[model samples]
Target chain A: MSASPGVWLAAIFTLAIYSFLYGDNPVYKFSEHLFVGLGAAHMAVMGWESMFNRAWTPLYTKGEWWWSGAIIGGIMLLTRWFRPIQWISRIPLGFMMGVAAGLSARSAIDSQFWRQIQSTVTMKLNTTNNIVYVVIVVCTLAYFLFAFNEKSGLGQGIKGVGLVGQYMMMIAFGASLGSTIMARLSLVIGRLDFLFKTWLGVLK
Target chain B: MKILRSSVPIWLGVFGGSIVLLAMFIKIPVHVGLWSKWFLEWRVILASFALTLGAGNLLRIHANRIRMKREAWMYSYVTIVALIGYTVLGILFKRTHPVYSFIFDNAYSPLSATVFSINAFYISSACYRAFRARNGHAAVLLLSGVIVMLGSVGIGYAIWPGFNTMTQWIMNYPNSAAMRGMNIGAALGIIGVSLRVIFGLERGHLGGE
Candidate 1:
């Protein structure tokens, strides 16, 4: 047992959530729901503070009342619950999605498309590695060319290249999956350490 | 009504999206050459408020459950109480409030971490079942995986001095090439989707009448 109430709460919640591994029960459900409620409430609190600082502060201190338009638009999101006025919700959703799309698309084009092609073409060192990289990239890109029928001779060649590309991808994915296991294992160890060391004080 | 249902939203998206898109290219010194700066802030402001949507939905769902006396309605009541309680404490005392921080530090932290860490057990079980080399491709993949995993740890380095070099070569050349190809394709896909949304073709996001 821990003297600190915070540690007790932490340990209890940790055990309760882990209890789900054994089987679903009321304790796990309580912990799960409690998490959801608390998480959302926390977000709301943070959002309110942020809005006050970013939107309201400017309007109050800097005399920029136009900032209120963003707040009003944001409040329209709650109209999602209203049946007749639900269409209004789309207004804000439209704004959010559009802004997000624009931001991502611009960055994606420059970073993902242009920058990658740029780097691949500029491989001036390590001649063997460069050639291998160029070949792998071209072949892997051929994997996405599904517009042509693979029954033709040229298409078959492309398909073969794509097959090699798939193998390369599988190798990468295997390394990724292996690393993912290790990462999750670290999380488990951290939690177990908290349980043993922090909660129970049984481990150094 | 048709205009309100679809056309309005589409144009709104295009208008909002175009603001940022154009800002990226064209430099307008409006508002002391900082209109774009404020527009970016507006984006954050808008998104912050949208965060409330999840809480709103949760409230309605659990409220309905409690109203109907559904199974485990007591849990729903617990959820509502927790939500209201935390929101009030958080709002009045700010996030740094001792009670709010206590709940977050203790309840939310442990619960979320435990939830995520629980995936480890299932993932290891899955790896055991999935890592079998039933074919040439599978064998190659598994071999690469084993080499990389072994090379990453001290024990494998102790066992074989070649593991690190082998893993580095595989990761740098073949893996990098493959990932670059996927990234380019995915970026093109993103541009395509963005254009669709801007053009009002991707109205699935808008739901229906």
Candidate 2:
């Protein structure tokens, strides 16, 4: 079956955008704004859609009485426009913050602290890999004990530990950077290939 | 007297904020009010305005760079040209139709992705340098790194079953614990900051005199 008009149009447009990889051109800029404007428009429409489907229709047509509370809360979110009434907007902000805080507090306990200690304490030493984990944990922890002076025994120990942590962090950062670059290159290649093979039919 | 002057705004902010919080739990059988909906929508509008301001700032900075003929002025020129070109095209075509779609899939997508793809080589080099065993703690880290790395590839399975198990243990246990603790602290801190803002105790964001 042949491709639909919409599909062909989208494919051609995609190629137009891909032409940008060679250098800065008019086509690339056009694509960039198209993405931004579409993104903004989509978000605005989504917000309105949610409010209509969730609040308006339910309350007006179906007579879902409880929706009034949501409508009130949502309206309160708009009070920031009037300088005199701006403080009224804080009502929803407070509720959002409170809920967010509670959720984060519970999640944090399970994910960050307890799990870290559990892993550190039950570490393996027999295998080469386990040995590295054990060392990293110890050294990284040691590096953080900065209460002591550099010349003193305790100070020197903590400093040494911090240095190890620093090294590990640097390594991680470098790896992250490399991955980012590779990702970018792949995108460029992908775009180029799409333009040439799909739209122009120059290469298969 | 001075504290009261500063505290009035804080009290109002806090009071309004608290009411909103209370509203969430009170299922009064009545539909949620229009006030909540308005508040959310208003925030989106305000946020959009702020985004426009940010874009303006970016443009201004680049324009200045070109005018002054600063180092890498050509790059600034390219940025300005690109920004204007895209903005104009979006306005002119005025639709997500074919003409507009062509620019998006080919240009912006590639730029964002190409910049991100260059990190793989940098990561490999970084990893090699980091895995060196200098001390007891360093040694443990080195060991964990190797295990995790090997486990990620098929080699760990061929080498030893224990390597994969150990790597999983490290990630599941210690890594998670540390991450969780940090997350908890961050949540608490966020709540505190939010409360302060609600109460107007934190006026720093407002840029007060």
Candidate 3:
């Protein structure tokens, strides 16, 4: 019922995608491929924009020659397709990976490892709930200890704690699953709202 | 050839990783801090290039499929045409152009949303089949999942006020505890692997022996 061409196109595309629910068909296949194409093109465009702004502009306009190294590395990355000079691509890959590794390692140690431990240890167990929370945290951590022998007395205690931890984890996973379902359903609702209200003009 | 293929890359990895890592602990030398910052920016540029390369790979695969006239080859033509056409439109007029925005808003956004929304149906079907309470653990999982799912929506509060309270308790205590424990373990694993990669002990990324 929408008069706009854009709305009409969107409805058609949405319908085309949803057609897969009925089973694989030509419309769904076409839409799937088209989606891939558009997605890839969008990525390429963003990449080009980044290269132009970050590397090209600085290298040419600002005369920052160091950025030229990035440009070279970017170009070198394309050599991955060529079997003869594919090894040349490793340099950029290595550089990128190293940077990623370094950043991740630093943040993981600082935020996840040290900060998490500090917070866990420093939590005040004044209330019953707080005490239960602390105990659950300890139990959860115990569950991850794979080095203990199950036959030993210490291991038996750990195993009992770990079972409680396992149950807590299951409950957590359930909550997570429930949250994901709700989120996905919200998207579905949004699409349905668009189809009915925007496209069909059925709802006020 | 050996150096280019192996040794040089390993050395570059070490240099790149070490400079960034060292800069975190060492703030005295101004140049080291500057280089570390520059390296991070360079990574963005490199990642952009990687994205473009991925697009190129997509093009190659589709073009090859079309040439070979394989199964569902007609779809390949659709992909190729859309990819080339959209890329040209975006490059020529830039992203802010009305035509580009129209295509993105109408085609891309709707398509993406619909694709994700489709998962709702599949997930519901899966839950119906898999959410049977076979044991105490299973019963707890099912009950928690049901409570949370109901409490999140308007109908659950209407049904029972206690649902919301129970949902909050499960999320605050057990959920938080489990996630924190998992996060700690994962962090340690990440640190170990990252250190290995930085030191060139992990050569999997280099591709092939």
Candidate that would win on DockQ: 3
| Candidate 3 displacement at residue A30 in angstroms | 0.6
Off by over 4 Å in 3: A148-157
**Who is ahead in TM-score, 1 or 2?**
1
Interface RMSD, one decimal, each candidate: 1.6, 7.5, 1.3
Give the runs in model 1 whose Cα sits over 4 Å from its true position: B28-36, B69-71
For residues A140-164, write the lDDT of model 3, one tens digit per residue.
Answer: 8888888989999999999999999
Q: Write the per-residue lDDT of candidate 1 for residues B1-209, one digit (tens) a residue.
A: 87876777778788767766667677654542255456567878887877877788889999999999998888987788888899899888888888777777888888888888999999888877668988877777788788888878888899998998988888898888989988888888898888777665667788743
**Residue A79 CA error for candidate 2 (Å)?**
18
In candidate 3, position B143 carries an lDDT of 83
| TM-score per model (chain B) | 0.87, 0.78, 0.91
lDDT of 1: 0.82
Candidate 1: tens digits of C-alpha lDDT, residues A1-204: 468988998899999988898899999888877887888888888888889998999988999987887788877877877889888878878767877787778888889999999998888756898888888888788887778887899999989999988888888777777767778899899999999999899998
What pairs collide in candidate 3? none
Q: Native contacts recovered by candidate 2, as a share?
A: 0.04
Model 1 residue pairs with clashes: none
Measured with DockQ on alpha carbons, how good is candidate 2?
A: 0.10
TM-scores of the candidates are 0.93, 0.54, 0.95
